[model samples]
Target: MASGKKRGKKPEVEFRNTQLADALQTQDMAAVAFALRHGPTVVPLMRPGARDDPRDTGEVWTFRDPKTGQVALLLFSDALHKPEAMPKAVGLHSPEWLRAFLEVHGDEITTVFFDIAGPHPMQASPADLIAALDA
Candidate 1:
C-alpha cells in the first residue's frame, strides 16, 4: 500500500490539499475514524518509544492512501519544513488536517486518475482506488 497504485477503470486523480479535506471531514464519525474511512489500508511504519533520538518518535504508518469507499487517504505529520517536506519522515497525517488542507487549497490540486499519470491530473475517485487495490 506504500506505492501509489492505479485504481479502477476511470483513473486515479492526484488529490491535492484541498480535495483531501472533504474526504476526511464532512462526516459523522470523529476525525480519526473519518480519516481511516478514506484510507484504503493502514501501513504501520513507526512505533512509540523505539529510539532515543528526538527526531525518531517511534511513530509508524502504512503506505499512501488507497482511496477505499469508507474514506480517502488523508495524510498528517509533524515535520513541517517550508511548504511540504516530501519523501521524509512520517507522522500522523490525521483526517482533521486533510479536511483543513483541502478546504484551503482544493483548487491547487490537479486531477489525473481518469487519464494516465501524465498529461492531466484527476481527483482519484473511490471506485478508481478500489480497482487499483484489486490490480
Candidate 2:
C-alpha cells in the first residue's frame, strides 16, 4: 500500500545561501503580485551581533514566514557603505520601507516574492510556518 502522503518528493530548500542571490536578481511585477494575492509573509530578523535580547532586535533585519515558521532575512540599509546603513527595524506601518525593501531583494527571492513586515501575516501554526519559511 502507498503511504497516505506522497513520497519520493524532492526535499525542500532551506537556507540555501548560494541560490539566494539568484532570486534577488530576477523579480517582476506579476511575481510580486502573486505573493500579495497569497498573503503577506516574512518578518525581518535582527542581526545576531546587533541585538542583545530578542526585544532589541531591529525591525528591518528579518522576515518571519507564516507557512514555514522560518524567519527569513530582511536587511535594512541606509548608506550601503556605512556600517550603520542597515535599515532601522520597521514594524507593519512602513509601507514605503516595504516597497524599497522588495526592490533591494529583487534578485534573490525565487520561491517567495514581495517583502513583508509586521507580525506574522496570519496565525501560523509552527509546522506551516516552518514549511513556508523553509521553502
Candidate 3:
C-alpha cells in the first residue's frame, strides 16, 4: 500500500517537573526547596558560549533523585557562574565552572532562598525539605 503522508518522529520526552519549573520561574525559594525535596529528577541543559563572549543567561537545570530517578526542571534567571575564588580564565556560566563550584561548595548548599533584589527573604532547612520530599 502507498501512502502520501510522511511519518514524523515522536518528540523525545525530557522530564521537566512542572512544580519545580513553576517554582524556579517565580524565584520562590520556599517552593524551590519544596520541589527539590519532593519533585522528580532533572538535568541541566548545557549550552556553551563562544570564547570571545562566554556568558549564558537563563539556564535550565534538571534535578534527579539518584534512588527513585524522579526528574524536575529549574530555570535560573542568570547563567551559573564560578565561585569568587575561581579565576576569570575559567569560563563563566559554563558547566565546567558549575561542576567545580559544586565539588567545592556542594556540602555548604543545604537550603534554597530567594535573595535576588527583593524584600522578605525566605529560608528552609535542608533536613526538613528532604523529609518533606521523601514523604
Candidate 4:
C-alpha cells in the first residue's frame, strides 16, 4: 500500500548579524574580515536556478551559529567593486588554508556562499554544506 502524507514545515530560523551588515553597508574589507574572524559559522549556498557549470559566478555563503541558531547571507562579487579594483583571486580554494580557517575561525564568517555576480541576496537554512565543511 502507498501512503500520501505531507511533511510538516520546519520552524523558521532568522539570520542576523549587525556587525556584518554594517561592514557590508560601509564596504569595508577590513571590517568584513574582522566580522568573519569573530562572528559566526558560514556555509556556502549555490545560486538558485543556476546551471551546474564548472565556471564560477556570484558566490554566496551563509553564516550561522549552532548555539544561537543565527544565520546571515554573505555575498561576494567583483561587481561590488570598481573595475580596476575588482578582486583578482581568492585563496579559499586552497585546502590547507581552508581547513586551517574553518578549524580556527569557523564560527565568525558572516556569509555562507561566495558569489561573483550582483544583487541576489537571499536567506537559506543550514544543511549538509556545513557538515562538508566540518569534514
Candidate 5:
C-alpha cells in the first residue's frame, strides 16, 4: 500500500554575529580576524528575477570599480546592517563558504570591505584575508 504524506517545512537558520559586530565597532583587527575565521558572514545576493522559490540562494553581490576595473567583495557581520543600495537579498554563509569564495575569487577581488557603507568601515587585501582564513 502507498501512503501520501507531505514533509513539514524545515527550520530556518538564524543569522547573527556578535563577535564580528563588536569587533567592527572597536576596530579590533585581531578580533575581526578571529571572528571571520570562526563566525558566519552576511553576503548580499543578486537574483535573475523575482524570487519564485524559497530555496533559492542567489549569486553573491560584488562591486567593480569603473576606473581600475577592480572588484571588491563586501562582507557584513549582520544581515540587518546591509545598506539599501545593495541587493535586497542576503544570505548567511559559514566560514567554509568564506574560505571557498576567497580561494575562487581571490584573483579577481583586489580588496575586501567589512561593513563597507558606514559605522567603522574596514578594508583588507584579498591576500591578507586568505592568510587569515588559512590561519
Candidate 6:
C-alpha cells in the first residue's frame, strides 16, 4: 500500500460544521443564524497561512466599499469553501470569537456574507447577525 503519495497528518481539530453548511445551502436566515451562534466558522485571514485549529486567531480579512465606506465580513462553513478570489489564508474561529468580533466591529461592518461568490451565497446585516448571536 506504499504508493508514492505522501499524506499529511490529520488536523487536531476539524473546522467544518455540517449544520452551517446545510443552512448556507438552503439560504435560510434563521437556520444560518442558529448555526452561526452554535457552531465554528471559517474566516479569511490577512496572514500567510491557514490554521486548522479554532484556537488560533488572526487578522480577519474584510472588504471595504470605496464609494459607501461600508465594510463586509466574509465567512464560510468550512475553509475549503472559501473562494479563490479571497485571501489564501484562513482561520477556524469559534462561536464566541465570532460574537466578540462582531460586537467590536459591528459599527463599521455593514454586511456579512456567507460563502460569498460560491454555490451557496447569503448576506445579512451586521446588526441582525449580532442580534441573532445574542439570541
Per-residue alpha-carbon lDDT of candidate 5 for residues 1-135, written as tens digits (9 for 90 to 100): 546777779897666687898988998888888998888988888853235864455689999999999999999887777899888878887788888889999999999998887576888998888888788
Residue range 62-112, candidate 1, lDDT tens digits: 223347423323233112211232334444334443344334443443221
> Measured by C-alpha RMSD in angstroms, how accurate is candidate 6?
4.9
Question: lDDT values of the candidates?
Answer: 0.33, 0.34, 0.41, 0.40, 0.84, 0.85
- Candidate 4: RMSD over Cα atoms? 14.9
Q: Model 3 lDDT vs. the true structure?
A: 0.41
In the range 1-135, model 4's lDDT, one tens digit per residue, is 546877779884333334545666665655555544444422233442234753443353344578887654433432232122333322123223334544544455443443323233322222322444344
Q: What overall lDDT, based on C-alpha atoms, would model 5 receive against the true structure?
A: 0.84
* Candidate 2 error regions (>4 Å): 1-42, 47-90, 113-135
Question: Clashes in each model (backbone N, CA, C under 3 Å)?
Answer: 32, 35, 13, 23, 0, 0
Shift of residue 17 alpha carbon in model 3, Å = 2.0
Per-residue error (Å), model 6, residue 7: 15
> What is the C-alpha lDDT profile of model 3 across 62-97, one tens digit per residue?
345588754322222222221223222221132344
Let me know the TM-score candidate 2 reaches against the reference structure. 0.25
Model 6 lDDT per residue over 1-135, tens place: 699988988877665778899998888889998998888888899973434854557789999999998899999888878878887987777788988999999888989998887678899988888888888
**Cα error, candidate 3, residue 14 (Å):** 4.0
If ranked by lDDT, best first, what sequence of candidates would result?
6, 5, 3, 4, 2, 1
lDDT of 5 at 112: 94
Q: Measured by TM-score, how close is model 6 to the native structure?
A: 0.81
Which scores greater on lDDT, model 3 or model 4?
A: 3
